[model samples]
Target: MASSSSSSSLKFTVRRCQPQLVPPAIPTPREVKPLSDIDDQEALRTHLPVIQIYRKQASMAEKDPVQVIRQALSQTLVFYYPFAGRLREGPHRKLMVDCTGEGVMFIEADADVTLDQFGDSLQPPFPCFHELLYDVPGTQEITNAPLLLVQVTRLKCGGFILAIRLNHTMCDGPGFKQFMSAWAEMARGATKPSIAPVWRRELLMARDPPRITCNHREFEQVQDTLPSSDQNLVQRSFFFGPLDIAALRRLIPQHLQHCTTFDLITACLWRCRTKALQIEADEDVRMMCIVNGRGRFNPPLPVGYYGNAFAYPAAVTTAGKLCRNPFGYAVELINKVKGEMTEEYLQSVADLMVMKGRCLFTTARSYMVSHLARLNLKEVDFGWGDAVYGGGAKAGAGRFLGVSYFCSAKNGKGEEGIIFPICLPAEAMERFAQEFNLMLGNKSQPQTSSATFIMSTL
Candidate 1:
């Protein structure tokens, strides 16, 4: 069982696990190559930094807290060796810790508000951890340790929120979650963690190198330089109640002739988005769905194989054709793409990594982003509660936007269904909402779409 503290200034409980005996070292040989040797230009871009924020009441933890956190961070770094790697092409990663030198002013009644309230109050042009870094033009060119920003706030009610930003390259969501759990365990004075960290690379190797069957080049996007335009990218959140999801589930069977929830909802959104954006008939539009690869591989992977364990199954259709058909047609497209999501495909993907002589995996930036999002991101939790909102680290990037949807089993209404963070043209977002609401027979509240709502709560 875990021990919990209910301080007026802090509302989180710590789970304590028994320590494990030190086991004899198991030496597993693996080969690791430098990023330059990988022949992947885009791959290098995927290693950008991540920003993290931590909030807490001024007096709740310790006096001179920056030193305390720095001390803890020093110990935490030992367990995360991936961060220790040197940047072969650029400067080393930088890890910075700063205090909320100045206190924040909140409306008096705001103290009782939940996480959702704080999220809603953020203005449209608000600064997420990423935006703060983006404002600095030359920051992206550097490759160092993840930029960790810790903000300690003193809430009127005494409790606080700890926000953490991590670079996607350091670890995927599951990898980061495990790291946090380990950190929390260490903070609570646990001598050992229930699950020891493993960094074996052989387990992730493909049986054959260059297992190519299909040409993946079609999915690649070439860029001479990063886009300078910052216009039209906006972030917005949408709430889908249980009834709304149930209606979608029912409609799938009636229309697409399928019984699954994901297929049905995805189809409907695709239709609405195409209609709203008023995309040209001949334009190529795709909806990329993430497929978890943990249990799908042959001789199933261990429960602890925590690196990237996902694949993208994308469905592409002309904007005009998609809008002209019934929602069921879109559902079939989803099913077809999903059918290709198998261990063979993943192995073949790995084979391509071997065949390309490790260069494709390193130089392919678009491939890295497209594939990294397929990993399981919904499992992160930090003791304040199971994550009601979890998503990719950064947002607003390419032609194929990424969206992830998950239901809250820990801190949301039982009647709540699924909430998705999506990215589409501004106009398309509105159409998606309108058509989605029509499918649910709820026409009262008009939908507003802008940028991808990276964080979501049901």
Candidate 2:
């Protein structure tokens, strides 16, 4: 794509807007410590970086979105004030919020561009991804940090993009959506939040004497080194219409037909990603699927608990076997691990980390995918009409070989489907696209032998 095409660097001017602090009367909780497993001992890593794109509110075109959102955010922060706090570097990579209500970084920018410039593509590296998101100033190393940053960019045609850059550890998808929902409701004049925010992480803390109940590979204490991926990366978006996703489901065995929308799509992506990279036969390839810890918790955490309740349960296998196996093999592997994300599994994870004593995540020969379909982004109205299009912006900010997020979108013909913003090495991306298309194109021919189908595409 058009995303990386040097079609004139996206031009924009940013006049740093006034910083917004937590409402004066809002109460701030005392600072909390990081989980004992601090990869901080090894590297200064920040939370998973994320951004969401929202089109301008047509009816409120003449209204001051900045003023509206700022005021609303301030009010919303009264209930979710921790987001206004700043992160303090503890030991290297580990961080704890100061909870002093320092406030979030806010910016206002203008571009001599129109939403049309993006031409239906929402992958990042588009003109605004850089201008609309903020990276902390100073050593440019992980030392400088902020809890949240919001950018409102006004386009020339009276349209605007609401870009949000926030730390992942502050909340999971539901928690973040709750915060945004509260802000939106406040902007629309809600006297109170729809859901009260809660912070009871201690309830789910590791048990004394650390009970171990799961045999997960993650529960072991081998102290394995994290994997590393290539530094040269590019992002692109792929759309799978309702029909395309259904076709993928049909590719698997009949008994496995109940595969989830995420499972079906990710299996395709994992295979294509592997083929694109052309890893050696003996090399190991891994896919880390994010699992929600909220449901897995015993007596599940409060529906309103605003904290990190996500886990990356991985599925690993050699590249040779991955490419050679039937499509059902990958489907079974993905579903199997996803099924293991239970309360027991989480307890074992807490206990294992307490014993091994380190936060370990890898960046090499790996791919991580998350589907935000539950965010129901299209239904998220903020006085402005529902977003023309909105989802995660693919910022290549971390060491992961590939980072992908999926969300619902209306294809060109207005058919319902999902848009996946994917980031991978440039060359790998080309192979990825070809493989993805080939797989979809083969759905009409269901009888093709699995080996024949995979090899012919390769």
Candidate 3:
């Protein structure tokens, strides 16, 4: 018998129902090409692990959903062809997508548990969540890995969890959302996507001369090499309802120009995560933000450019200063870093990465944030009314991969709230929960300024 804490107690079992490999409708002109280091970097951004749940309801089509989704994906891949390709070895020991028209792996799984068993508080980095996602077991590298692998697990209650594992370099969060939405649309009988994908890799290609034209602080290489780290971290979900969000925003002064929801939550997270970790007073801290570069450009990326159009913009600070200071100061620091993510700066960042010939991001003393608050979860319908849950699967893996995500979900009143997920040390998590509850429960005090003391029960 499994232990009480074991996910086995949940009665989850994943077995291959059938081999479902769906390829594009058309044959691709055979071509083998080397992905530019920038493109290569994006391609290997992640195992691109994602897990979403959609409860079976009367609103869904009466037809077979597996077949419907499979057909839709097959048709969608005709336009988004790169997904059907597999990664292969390149000359420099780097990776490249071998554009051989191989289909994506689609598996059907069954679990004895019911969706109701999960209740409404479903979240990620769950104990058995890792088992739900499909990947090459025991390996994290994407080389020679299938570009896409999806597993659909049917629950006892008839609802299902759709787990998608893709190569991160294939698309950014926004781009992936675009592809999935179109796939959903095709499932609804659309001939083609409303906004056809634009696959012009050259838009992000390195320049002919590969020159560093402008200042690029984001790409500057670190002079010191940090030692290895592996903190036994656990992921948890933190939800902030409308009122809680408003209260947080109120904490920041309104007169501050860039004082938006993004800055408000970022301030809360940065401060709380820092204090939770109990970093030294002088220890460096930074919030690495993934900013979409599409709009920052003059002729913004075409509507359907389902490729990486985002840049990592980080805000650096010290742990003691971030936690000790008022929330307004953190917001200001965030806004300043945000203001620099202009078109000119984005171009320079590209040039700098091109000069370095590698795609890397800030690692040490950094807490990254990916705000998916704007993702329209309702549109991800595969003939169902809407997905019961649609958001990020795992924030990330390991301590060095410090990441926090702010996502959205529809509530009973058709309203949206942010779902922030993070993984921290067990002891830190205890402190974090106490500190967060204190901040949210302090409704009696007016959020005057950061200087005002906020008491905590912990």
Give me the candidate number with maximum TM-score: 3
| Per-residue lDDT of 124 in model 1 | 20
The TM-scores, one per candidate, come to 0.65, 0.84, 0.87
lDDT head-to-head 1 vs 3, winner: 3
lDDT-based ranking: 3, 2, 1
Q: Write the per-residue lDDT of candidate 3 for residues 173-257, one digit (tens) a residue.
A: 7888999988989989999999888876667766666666655445544432333323445556766777877777767776774
Error of 2 at 311 (Å): 1.7
Residue 309, candidate 1: Cα error in Å is 2.2
lDDT of every model, 2 decimals: 0.42, 0.64, 0.67
> lDDT tens digits, residues 1-458, model 1?
23332222323333212211111122222223232111122322343222222234344445333333334443444544343332333322211212111111111111232333333322121233332222222223324323232332223333333334343333445565566666555544454455676654355455643456654542444332323223444444444555665666665545455535666656766676556656567665667655666678677766544455555556777777777765667778877877777877765655555555433221111211132222333333222233333343333332223343432221133443344445544555566667667777882233222223433211
Predicted structure 3, TM vs. truth: 0.87
- Top lDDT hit: 3
lDDT of 2 at 365: 65
